[model samples]
Target: MELLIKWLSIALSSSVKFFAGPLLGKVYNLPWWQTAICSFLGMMVAVILFSTVARAFFHKYMKGLFNRNERRITPNKRRMVRIWNKFGISGIAFLTPILLTPIGGSIVAISFGTHPMKIIGYMAVSAAFWAIVASIGIYFIPFNFH
Candidate 1:
């Protein structure tokens, strides 16, 4: 029961913030492989939920809230567009685990009209890769903060 709780905590935190997975895993002393899988699953859950269900919900209920013609182009949006133009979905996926929350990344992808499957695929790959990388880093590397 305690073990399940720890894993669930890691997964829940990872869903909101990818970096928290590794940190929580380290705190809980879980195996690196388990940490990696949990982290990947957590982020993927958010990505899938937002990319599919949330997108549908937005289109149905909040479509009128985002009138493209009336929307102002903020600097943040400009930067996102620049990145999208330069690297497309791959770039977004690459940055998602490191920079953006899973929900945030999914919303960005959906806003740019990325297909749901494509969002899932790219996010899955990114989450798996980063989960492994972060788990290894947190588990194996000893950081002595003074």
Candidate 2:
């Protein structure tokens, strides 16, 4: 079904870029609720699975590899750390979906040692909120594709 494929596309999109899912929804002319829910669901699932698995893998193997870079922080990483320090987990989660893809956000959260459940909760809420914003913005843009 087209809807199923569309939903899957939106879900997968969250892993790559912010606003991708919502943009897909607008392009597909999906209802606002469906757009929001699908986007949230996609981000939630991606974050939960990615964070948990990544955490486990990191703890088991990647920890030592990352320790090599502990002495030198990239500028981007320094900025991210500053943001993390200023806003903490909640703020990061709420803003991640807009600032970064679900996967990128999860990676950042994991790097900062945030709990996976909290990341999922915050990202889900963010995804839903952003989806609503995107839908509304697109709807009111005066550009009718119909």
Candidate 3:
């Protein structure tokens, strides 16, 4: 029905931005708030789905996909590990949204042994923050000048 289509459109549009904000912004003609809300919601969905996938299917079915190639943990890795260790789930959750893709962030949180609940909580907050900032930036900046 019409209502279902509309809801589906909103969900799809928002979810796409959740994964790829810049690309979705160009394609959807959505204002920043729309994008933000949709993207945040989408990211939350993605995080939850990803957490489930990572635990139930991805680890076994997509082992190669998630496999680490680098042998050296590197200074950045060390720093991340240290932060995660120090702050526990909070650190991973807070950083995941900003530092990684919805999928990547979820994977990293899992790899770091962050709890699923904490991962979702952190990602939700981080996604909301970025969405707000992105929306504000898009709204205030003038574009398409005559």
Candidate 4:
């Protein structure tokens, strides 16, 4: 139970900040590869939770929190829709992690009518790649010790 809570917190934290890779890595005290894997897993869990359960809940109970101009960017939506129509799930999965936080990216992908499975697969891959790269970069970069 405690472990589940900890992992859930990590997922939520990573979902809120796409850049939480390093923070999570440190907290888990994970080596570079493990950190990358855990971060990616956390992000994937977040995407799934947001797209299914949280999305409906937010729409029903916390709509105001997500109601913003950002959500209604018509031109951007059109562009995203076009891209989604053309590239299908791959485009959204590839783009979401780079372009938005896990929750926000998943929301946009869902709004664009992306298939949930594709969104999950692609976003998971993208998140894994980025987390690995970020984790390695952070772990390897040397800072001068004063």
lDDT of each: 0.91, 0.78, 0.66, 0.71
Better of 1 and 3 by lDDT: 1
lDDT of 1 at 103: 95
For this target, which candidate reaches the highest lDDT against the unseen true structure?
1
**Regions of model 2 farther than 4 Å from truth:** 144-146
Worst 10 residues of 1 by lDDT: 137-146
Model 3's lDDT to the true fold?
Answer: 0.66
Candidate 1 lDDT for residue 32:
93
* True-structure lDDT of candidate 4: 0.71
TM-scores of the models, in the order given: 0.92, 0.87, 0.67, 0.67
Query: Model 4 off-target regions past 4 Å?
Result: 1-10, 24-29, 54-86, 143-146
Off by over 4 Å in 1: 144-146
Q: How many residue pairs clash in each candidate?
A: 0, 0, 0, 0
Error of 1 at 65 (Å): 2.6
lDDT per residue, candidate 4, 26-131, as tens digits?
5555577766666787788888887787657656876665566566558776777787789877777777666768887888776655567777878888888788
Clashes of 4: 0
lDDT per residue (tens digit) for residues 1-146 in model 3? 85344434544544444435533553456666666676677777878888876666666776665476956668877877797779776676666655656777787677765678878888888878877776667556665523
Tens digits of per-residue lDDT, candidate 1, 112-141, equal: 889999999999999999999999998888
Model number with the top TM-score: 1
What C-alpha lDDT, on a 0 to 100 scale, does residue 122 get in candidate 1?
Answer: 96
lDDT for 137 in candidate 3 is 70
